[model samples]
Target: MFNDISGKYDFLNHLLSFGIDKIWRNKLLGSITFASDSKVLDMATGTADVALQIAKEKGVEVTGADISDGMLDVGRVKVKTKKLEDLVQLVNGDAENIPYEKETFDIATVAFGVRNFQDLPQGLIELHRVLKADGQLRVLEFSKPKSSFVFWFFGLYFNRILPFVGKLVSKNNTAYRYLPVSVNAFPEGQDFCDYLRNAGFTEISFKPLTFGISTLYICKK
Candidate 1:
C-alpha cells in the first residue's frame, strides 16, 4: 500500500496539511536537545524530510531507513541536490528490524510513521535497542484533539476534506483513506507514553502540537 503511493506521498502530504507538516517537522527537530556530533537514525523516513532537517539544523549525521525503495529514491535525489550526501544517508530497512547493531545511535526519530508498523511494540523495542544509554527517542504522530468542538471540526476535515484533496492530487484513494483510519486506530496521550515506558524508556513525555492535531513523544533510554 505504501509502496504504491510512494511517488506522490511527499507532494500530497504537504498539500493536504497546508504546509503545516513542514512546520510540525521543524518543531519536532527543535524539540530535540541533542549535542553536537550526535548520531541519529530516522526510521520509516519517507523522503528524508525530518532526517534532512535534523542534519541541516543540528549538524547531526543522519541515517534514514525505510522499507520502500521508491521513497528512498526520492530521498537520495534530495540528499544529492542539497549537497548533504556526506551528512545524510538513506538505506532500505524495516523499522521493526533496524539494520544497525544495538546501542548504535545517540537518538532515534520517526515522524508520522509509527502507526504504519505491522507490530508497533516490536518496532518500539527495536528503536529502544538501537539507542545508546540515556539516548532519546522522538516520535511525531497525529492525534485527535481533546476539545470536543475542535475534534468535530478536525474529524470533518481529516475524514472528508483532506482525503478528497489527497485523492484529487495523488489519485490514490485507499492511501488517503488509510491515513485517517491509521491515526484513529493508534493510541494517544498517556496510553502511548505508557507503551514507551513499558519498552524500557524513562523520562517519557509528550507534547500536543497544533491544538492536539499532532503529538510529539520524547523518551530516554
Candidate 2:
C-alpha cells in the first residue's frame, strides 16, 4: 500500500498538513536528547524525513527502517542529495520484528507510523528492545481534536476534504481512505500511554499539537 503511493507521499503530506507536520516533528526533536556518538533508530521511517532531520546533529548516526523499499529509495535520494549519507542509512525492515540486537540505539522514533503497525504492542516492544538502558522514545501521530468546535471542523476536513485531496493526488483510492479509519481506531491520549508503560517504558507523557490534531509521545526506558 505504501509502495504504491511512495512517489506522491511527501507532496501529499505537506499539502494536506499545510506544512504543519514539520513543526510537529521539530517539537518531537526538542524532547529528544542524546550524546555525540549516540545512534538513533527511526522505525517505520517512511521517506526518512525524521531520520534526515536528526542527522543534522554533529555526530549522530541515524538508521531509518521501513517495510517499503520504494519509500526507502526516495529517502536514500534525499539523504544523498543532502550529503548526509555518512550519518544516515536507510534499511528495509518491519516494525514488529526489527532485526537489530537489544539495546542498540540510544534513541528511537516513529513519525506518523505507529497507527499503521499490524501489532501495536509487539511493535512497541521491539522498539523498547532496541533502545539502550536510558534510551528515549518519541512518537508523532495523528489524534482526534479535543475541542468540540475544532473536532467538528477537523472532522469535516479529515473525513471529507483530506481524503478527497489525497486520492486526487496519489491516485490510490484505498490508501487515503484507510488513513482516517486507522486514526479513529487508534488508541490516542492516555490509552496509548498505557501501551508505552506496558512496553517497559518509564516517565511516559504526551503533548497535543495543532489543537489536538496530532500528538507527540515521549517516554524513557
Candidate 3:
C-alpha cells in the first residue's frame, strides 16, 4: 500500500496540511536536546524527512528505518541531492524488528507513524531497547480535538475532504481512505501514554498541537 503511493506521499502531505506539517516536525525537533555525536533512530521513516531535517539542523547522524523500498529510494535521492549522504542513511527495516542492537541510539522518533505499527507495543518496546539510558522518544500523531466544534470540523475534513484530495493527487484509492480509519482506530492522549508506560518509558508528556489536530508525545527511557 505504502509502496504504491510513495512517490506522491511527500507532495500530498504538504498540500493537504497547507505546509503546516513542517511546523509540527519543528515542534518535535524542539523537544530534542541535541548533543555532539548524538545518534538518532527514526522509526517508520518514510522518505526520511525528519532524519534529513535533523542532520541539516544539528549536523547529527541519523539512521532512518522503514519497511518501504519505494520510500527509501526516494529518500536516497533527496539525501544525495542535498549532499547529506554522510549524515542521513535510510534502511529497509521495521519498527517491531529493528536492525540495530539495544542501547544504540541516543534518541528515537516517529512522526505520524506509530498508529500504523502492526504491533504497536512491540514496536515501542523495540524503540525502547534501542535507546541509550535516559534517551528520549519523540512522537507526532493525529488526535481528536477537545472542543466539540473543532472535533466535528476536523472529522468532516479528515473523513471527507482530505481523503478525496489525497486520492485525486496520489492516484491510489484505498491508501487515502485507510488513513482516517487508522487514525480513528489509534489510541491517543492518555490511552497512548499507557502504551508508552508499558514499553518502559517515563517522564511522558502529551502536548496537543494546532488545537489537537495533532499531538506530540515526549518520553524518556
Candidate 4:
C-alpha cells in the first residue's frame, strides 16, 4: 500500500497537513536529548526524513527502517543527494520484529508510524529491547481533537475532503482513506501510555499538538 504511493507521499503529507507535519516533526526532534555518541534508530522511517535531519544536525549514526522499498529507495537518493551516506542508512525492517540485538541503540523515533503497527505492543517491546538503559524513544502520531469545534471541522476534513483531495493528487484510492480510519481506531492518551508501560517504558508521557490533532509520546527505558 505504501509502495504504491511512495512517489507522492511526501508531497501529499505536507499538503494535507498544511505543512504542520513538519512542525510536528520538529517538535519530535526537539523532544530528543541527544548523547554525543547517540546511535539512533528510526522505525517505519518512510523517506528517512527524521534520520537525515538528525544526522545533519548532530552528525550521528542513524539507521532508518521501513518495509517499503519504494520509500527506502527515495530516502537513499536523498541521503546521497545530501552527501549523508556516512551518517544515515536506510534498511528494510519490521517494527514488530526488529533486526537488531538487545540494547543496541541510544535513541529511537517513530513519526506517524506506531498506529500502523500490526502488533502495537510487540512493536513497542521491540523498541524497548533495542534501546540502551536510559535510552529515550519518541513517537509522533495522529489523534482525536480535543476541542468541539476543531473536532467537528477536522472530522469533516479528515473523513471527506482530505481523502478526496489525496486521491486526486496521489492517484491512489485506498491509502489516504485508510489513514483516518487507522488513526480513529488506534488507542490514544493514557490508554496508549498503558501500552508503553507494559513494554517496560518509564516516565511515559504525551502532549497533544495542533489542537489535539496529533500527539507526541516521550518515553525512556
Q: What are the RMSDs of all candidates, in order?
A: 1.0, 0.8, 0.7, 0.7
Model 3 poorest 10 in a row by lDDT: 40-49
Model 1 lDDT per residue over 161-191, tens place: 9888878877876888889999999998899
Candidate 3, residue 174: CA error in Å?
0.5
Model 1 residue 139 CA deviation in Å: 0.5
Q: What overall lDDT goes with each candidate model?
A: 0.91, 0.94, 0.94, 0.95
Model 4 stretches with alpha carbons more than 4 Å out: none
lDDT (C-alpha) at residue 186 in model 1: 97
Candidate 3, 109-189: lDDT as tens digits: 999899899999999999999999999999999988889999999899999999999999889999989999998999999
How far off is residue 162 in model 4, in Å?
A: 0.9
Task: Name the 10 consecutive residues with the lowest summed lDDT in model 4.
Answer: 28-37
Candidate that beats the other on lDDT, 1 or 2, i.e. the better one: 2
* Model 2, C-alpha of 8: deviation from truth (Å): 0.3
Clashing pairs for model 4 are: none
Model 2 stretches astray by more than 4 angstroms: none
Candidate 1 — what's its lDDT?
Answer: 0.91
- On lDDT, the leading prediction is 4
